[model samples]
Target: MAEASLLAASIAVLVGTVAILVNRVRTPAWVRDAQLTLNASAVTSLLLLVCGALLVALVLAFGIFLLATRHGVVGRAMVCLAATGIAHLGVTVRRH
Candidate 1:
């Protein structure tokens, strides 16, 4: 039962992260402006793409951690980190 709950929670976080990435990609200009405030316009787009890729990498890392680790402090910590990422993404999504 506990394992099931943990799996569900991990999946939810993965989905949320992907959703946020998709929404950000849909508005490249906004993402560039928001993420690279001081950078030149020419480079902002590339930087934004890097940021998106980084987020995708983070999600992948977290997913792998969740899958490969056993239920314990490490698992709980990963879940907490995932939740934090989701909440941060939620705020970012709302802002733009």
Candidate 2:
């Protein structure tokens, strides 16, 4: 179950990673405004993205911890949640 949980989490994160990598230019939307308004200033957008990414990273780390501790269900849930966040972070017009 733990292995399966890790697999699912990795897959979820991979999907978002692919979405981000597929873009040749830019994601256009950062973490703040998923609608791609681009209303935030350059620095502001960058900051928001950075902050959001950090938050996601923290969640991902926690998910990892849960997995290590053999909390399969919670780990899977947290990891999936983090992956959705990252996907939205990359895909645009969506929020985690």
TM-score of candidate 1 on Cα atoms, chains taken together: 0.40
Compose the digit string of candidate 2's lDDT tens values, residues 1-96. 776766677776767666664562254444444434555456666677888899889999999999899987778777877877776576432332
Residue-level lDDT tens digits of model 1 in 1-96: 776676667667767767776677679696677656534464655575557557755865775576577545446546555555655555454444
lDDT of each: 0.60, 0.68
lDDT of 1 at 85: 64
- The collision pairs in model 1 are none
